[model samples]
Target: MYFISTSSPDEYSTKVDRMIGENMDLTRDLEFWMSKLPACLRALPIIYLSIPGSHNSFTSNISGGSIVSLDSPKILQNLEWIYCIRHIMANWTKNQNVAVKEQLKAGIRYFDLRVSAKSRENNLYFCHGMYSCKVEPVLNEISTFLETHSKEVVILDFQHFYGFTQQTHGKLMQMLLKTYGTKLLPYSDHMDHLSLDYMTSQFSYQVITVYRSDAARFGQPLFWPSASFPTPWANTIDHNALFNFLDDKIKDRKDNVGFITQIVLTPTLTDILFNSCTTLEQKLAIDFEDLRTGWISKQTPGRRGVNIVIGDFIDLSDNLFTKTVINLNLKLLRDLPKRMTSPIN
Candidate 1:
């Protein structure tokens, strides 16, 4: 719900033009859209954005197993995310601000197309088979852009790719900060959902942000069924024990590295959070799971779950917790720990 649209005024004009082209009136649908925003669940301190900045008001917490209810599969507010993507794609073609457009496109390429299957399978945290192509050039372009323009640039590498500190990504940030005097913006996304501990003590800070994707992207609910295709289920689990362990790993690693955190929530859960768009929120509540359960033999199809929801890669405040990752997660993890434990809890 909290869309950190840093798109310039030109982007706005483009969007408005699209609205006009669609023959839809923004004023007429103002309240309608507002109503579609998510509402915070009563039980938890979940944050929903009825309007811009509303989400900023709510603090973030990691939701482990209960990812966007596997039912909807449509990323939380899929239409909105898609809209933003299309908007960026539209601008990526021919915007006056070439730098901004390119940067935005790089972001889209990284978050939208690259990090589709982002998830923590075991101890690895993050994986990247999804991106068969190298992202080096994109990183170079982004670094150059940041070095030239952004003030306190925040990378916010949302577990979108594999390792932010991976040589390619690390060097890009270094080039930017080193080439220009601008300090590299810290990366902030999901720590548990990524494998960043391989870097040196301070290296991860420059490369990775804490995991907020799980909360902002996955923690909440959407819609899904009991059994289905290649796998009977869609969503696995989003719970506290897993989050607690992941948080501990992140906390333990805090000493050597600096990081930013994000939030996660499901679709229906997100609808309840923002409370911005009432009708859409309600419409999303429909049982998408009930509708699609069983084999994909023209009957059931995999739900396009909320894979990623990116935010403006900008800093909020300077003051932050400086905890030493006393209990390093990487060290404790066993290759397929769950396999040794019989049935994973």
Candidate 2:
């Protein structure tokens, strides 16, 4: 079984310091925490389950030059790569850098995907203002992860759609249905004990798809509306305020719907230009300990019980925050023997 030592912050601190000095090995494989859960805890409703996710998960590949058009000249590309501009550009773009499969291994069960169609060729790509890699390959990676880790379930939330005609949305939905097929879980009115157990069983299929557009729903029960999944926007530069905003939402959240605690800082124009030297990695590193002890640790006792906790740089510092969230789930397991056996509606 996978074991995570929660006793020391130094393990993460040292890793982050090394990353800044050398290569960033955020994708280094770790133990599969979800699959290691006790049987009773595994039987709980996924909406009540604690899940770690990435905000703009597909944007790890986005750089300043990549966000710009391919037609741009070499000179422009070179200038954009300069330290200040790159850091500034990093603010708006590049929330994550680790690939999807790596994130899966690191115990991230939820993926916050933004999709866009590129051209008449009908190619769909992952996007956040500007585009990144194509969508299908990433989905393929997720599929591969699911295949290997049958006991583990994942949440695919297509929260944003851009550069798409109405027809494109339908096409995208068709593509997803075809690709995922029966593996996708249909919507359930009540996340009772039986349904939860069935969904998480090794023999049963898994995937909770939350699609933003109604055009793409295709009357399929698998697709959930935005209202059922609340992913509050983090439009603030103040790190503390961002957490406070999420804290307020968490306090007021409805038990029926799933919640996404977006732990990220949205840098304003001033933060971008003035604080150009600091990378997203550095910011996350600085805030990591405080967030773990002050924010995430305090969340387990709340009514909602922390559904999906998303953040930028999930794979950073060797999956520090991801492990923290997963450990929170593990912490829930001790009480599960009683809860799981009881008839939960």
lDDT of each: 0.23, 0.67
Q: Number of clashing residue pairs in every model? A: 72, 1
Which 10 consecutive positions of candidate 1 have the poorest summed lDDT? 318-327
Residue runs of model 2 more than 4 Å from their true location after superposition:
1-31, 69-87, 119-121, 192-196, 283-289, 333-338, 342-345
Which run of 10 residues does model 2 get worst, by summed lDDT?
19-28
**What lDDT does candidate 2 reach at residue 151?**
72
lDDT of 2 by residue, 1-345 (tens): 122233466653453344233422222334456665544446665666677888888887776555532222446345754655554564556788788877787788889988876545557888764558888888888887778877777888998787677877878877778777888877765554323457766446677788888775557786777777788876886667877788788878876677888877776556656656676567543565455435876677223567889888876556678766765654453343234443212
TM-score of each: 0.23, 0.79
The best candidate in terms of TM-score: 2
> Residue 308 of candidate 1: its Cα lDDT?
18
lDDT of model number 2: 0.67
How well does candidate 2 match the true structure in TM-score terms? 0.79
